[model samples]
Target: MKLKRARRSRRGRIEIIPMIDVMFFLLATYLLASLSMQRLDALPIALPDGKTAPLPSAAPLTLSIDRQDHIEVGGHAVALADVGNAVRQQLHDDRKVIVAADDKATQGTVTRAMLAAQNAGARALLIVIRHEG
Candidate 1:
């Protein structure tokens, strides 16, 4: 003969708070990672709209033309006349140059900037434009 004994039952549980914390961490990590992966080569300005194209793989020189007609190369202030020289100095082997001009910039200024870069030996002159609707 044996004595009867009481039994205890164990129930598995899922912690919701920890799971939510992990998800938030993952979300923040992905957001930061994506932001880091982007390549920002030029200053922020109002760009015009035009046909779109893929960016070149090689690191290209950025030439920014503000609405006030001020020119900058690789984040450095440069004169309009010195644009060619600046391009020649900063351009890589791919000869890729990105021209970012403001939407309010004069047509002549943009044209001259493009020509200056081209004359400086930029084989791939990519003009940055706004995305079409």
Candidate 2:
């Protein structure tokens, strides 16, 4: 006598739960990797230290000077002669300005930029320096 065999049934539907988990893991991994690769926009420099003070409520204008003595007002490059005018245009009622100078930059260049900020009617001037480690 021949025995009869039963065939198992199979479902063709796709499983989505595992795929969603894998996608989430990949997204998290990429996010972490991207964060590690982020960089600061300001030029690296050694800064002087002083007593910490509260920042003003209004956003202050940023002026940067690189080692090469290149001057930038609010991230836009400007000639030394035009620094004052550029600063003036950005000044509002707050009239605050922040100057960041590279450690290798000459004192003369930094002084000139500070003077320009003053001439532009900056009521408050703040120098940005790296905190001593």
Candidate 3:
């Protein structure tokens, strides 16, 4: 039997064009994702330098308003009418109150909580908001 010469197989080559296309697609996707993460209308806030500031005499009181208009103080739920009394009970020499209201919370609810804090003799009131990126 006559032996036939074996043909050499073609070597596989890496396609740089396809690799470049894939890299560009990934870059564009990441760029768009980063752009969308930015908040356009977010207000810039300058925080106080704590190095020279006096230390707080006491921890700040945290009060929260939920979307359902429920009021919470120190992780305990309290009635809207009783919010002032509850805050008064927790007040010490420092009467600083921080109100954290949900984005979906109604304006009336937030206003009521703030009023309660004021009625409870809070000297300073601060609203807590989520920091935008």
Candidate 4:
């Protein structure tokens, strides 16, 4: 009469909280698909409506304009008398300038591209509307 058996050795585990919730949902879906594939320097306008503001913190300088008026800045092809020396060589220290015309552009080429971004010092001249809602 020989009967004595009892063996249960469970081993094999790797849960890490659902692998850290699927690596935070694939890092939040690769940061919302790389922030919706960002890459819009400027140009391609039709904006006019207005009332939106609030967008500083540096990185403004766009200054586009189309409808045959031509002229550009950050996207190159600038002329209109060198658009104030291409907005003073893309002013740094955050002079802040946007413009982005072309709602049939020609209020004297959007007021001469906002007076050439205030003669290039551009103390701040944002103007790229289109919100009227």
* Local distance difference test scores for all models: 0.86, 0.84, 0.75, 0.82
- The sequence of per-residue lDDT tens digits that candidate 3 reaches over residues 67-115 is 7777787667888898999889887577888777777778888898889
List, residue by residue over 34-128, the lDDT tens digit for candidate 4: 99999776778788887886675656778888888887788888778788888888776778887778889788877977886797698988777
TM-score of 1: 0.71
Provide TM-scores for the models.
0.71, 0.66, 0.55, 0.36
What is the alpha-carbon lDDT for the whole of candidate 4?
Answer: 0.82
Candidate RMSDs in Å, in order, are 3.3, 5.7, 10.6, 11.9
Give stretches of model 3 more than 4 Å off.
1-58
Would you give me the overall lDDT of model 2?
Answer: 0.84
- Candidate 4 residue 11 Cα shift, in angstroms, is 8.2
Residue 94's lDDT within candidate 4 is 72
Best by lDDT, which number? 1
Candidate 2's displacement at residue 108, Å, is 1.1
Model 3, residue 66: what's the lDDT? 71
Where does model 4 exceed 4 Å of error? Answer: 1-6, 9-16, 43-47, 50-63, 66-70, 81-106, 110-129
Kindly list the per-residue Cα lDDT of model 2 for residues 1-133, writing each as its tens digit.
9877687688788789999999999999999999999845565566676556656676688888888888888878898999999999887777888888887889998998899899989988888866554
Q: Scored by Cα lDDT, where does model 3 land?
A: 0.75
